[model samples]
Target: FNDGRIQQLAPPEDLYERPENGFVAQFIGENNTLEGTVETIGEGNCTVRLGDGSVIDALPVNVSRAGERTLLSIRPERAEFNLDRLPEGTHTVKAEVLEFIYMGDIFRVRLRIAGNENFVIKCRNAVGQRRLRPGEVIDVGWLPQDCRALEAA
Candidate 1:
């Protein structure tokens, strides 16, 4: 799934480590995806103004229009986890731990955000697994740069 001109330029490892575009990054395994608008563009980066008015700086991509809405995708692993601390941004959601399953080398954490959307976050088993129980409230965060502006659907 990670082989193409774009994928070749950024090998699978490098693509996930540092994606060249929002689509490439999310397709690799990013969570916390949202939609936004292109506020401005730079030489190597562009500012995506989210629906909530938060601006995210990300690699340049083809936005629909100057003011058209776009999708913002983020990987949960890239998010900072803290029960008491919350990151500053426009897209912040409180999710409840629905289940944590051990799938060999990775731990699959299933969460329900806003009681409507379900999100899955993959973490290495070396983390020793999370102690949070089902229904436990947890804080999820995503940085602006960590998010990307995608074409509108």
Candidate 2:
């Protein structure tokens, strides 16, 4: 609830999978929020023009038409650095690796993308996983459905 008003009420899975607005999206878990403007709207998806003038496809969750400001929400774990692992038609953005922390079971990778220096991506500690280094540039991609375009906060 925001400011003593109910924002959304649903099961735990539903709350995380589908947030109603920016508030719910942020309150639920760790999310990478990118501020952008809607460039074009399509069936079940839309293209967002980021501050860097790059366009990315995203699922319109709370955004309506073109020209509307939106905050694209993506989970760090949902983002993939390996293009081969990502599905076809996924739009990729350049990300600079700022820091890499090796956790017990997961590696926390901090990246800078679209002018957001705090953006992060989590990679599981497994075989065949590539180790990221600071100052390294890489392409990050995620499925459009995994990125939710919510109302600007």
Candidate 3:
């Protein structure tokens, strides 16, 4: 992947949205991953407690048991910023704005969440979007369906 491409024979949407594994998720697009343990798993969703104690409600991509390690993969664009009030069954985590860059077409935000680095939010740079300031401590979230819960390893 350093200089070559990975070819995966997958449906276009699967490659972008529901990747088969971490390899595909990392290879096909920009994705944010978090390490955690499965807190609970029910009918259609799973709860994960991240490394820093942040809990995430995510779509259950694969069936897993409580206390088992898991991974949560979500795209930055799926991670909405301020103004999108955290809804029930959504993930809430504290993050500080490391840097916010306006790149014409979109707003690229660098964040430090729960001590994890390189966490980004590629949001729209439009009229209604929330403009963030560096050093701001804020709550960012995503809907359960927006994030996929996968095996940790």
For every model shown, the clashing-pair count is 4, 0, 0
Q: Candidate 3 lDDT, tens digit per residue, 21-124?
A: 67778877799988888899998888888888988888877646999887788899888776345576455789999999999989999999867778898887
TM-score of 3: 0.87
Provide the TM-score for each candidate, comma-separated: 0.56, 0.97, 0.87
User: Positional deviation of 36 in candidate 1, in angstroms?
Assistant: 4.6
* lDDT tens readout by residue for model 2, 1-153: 889999999998878888878898888888898999999998898999999887899999888999999999998989999899987878999999999999989999999999999998999999999999999999999999889999997
Q: Score each candidate by Cα lDDT.
A: 0.61, 0.92, 0.81
- Candidate 1: pairs in clash: 31-75, 34-72, 35-71, 36-70
- Measured by lDDT, the strongest candidate is 2
How far in Å is the alpha carbon of 70 misplaced in model 3?
1.1
Worst 10 residues of 2 by lDDT: 12-21
- Comparing 1 and 3 by lDDT, which wins? 3
Q: Which regions in candidate 3 have their CA more than 4 angstroms from the true location?
A: 1-9, 85-89
**Model 2: lDDT of residue 129:** 93
- Can you give the lDDT of residue 56 in candidate 2? 93
Candidate 2 structure lDDT: 0.92
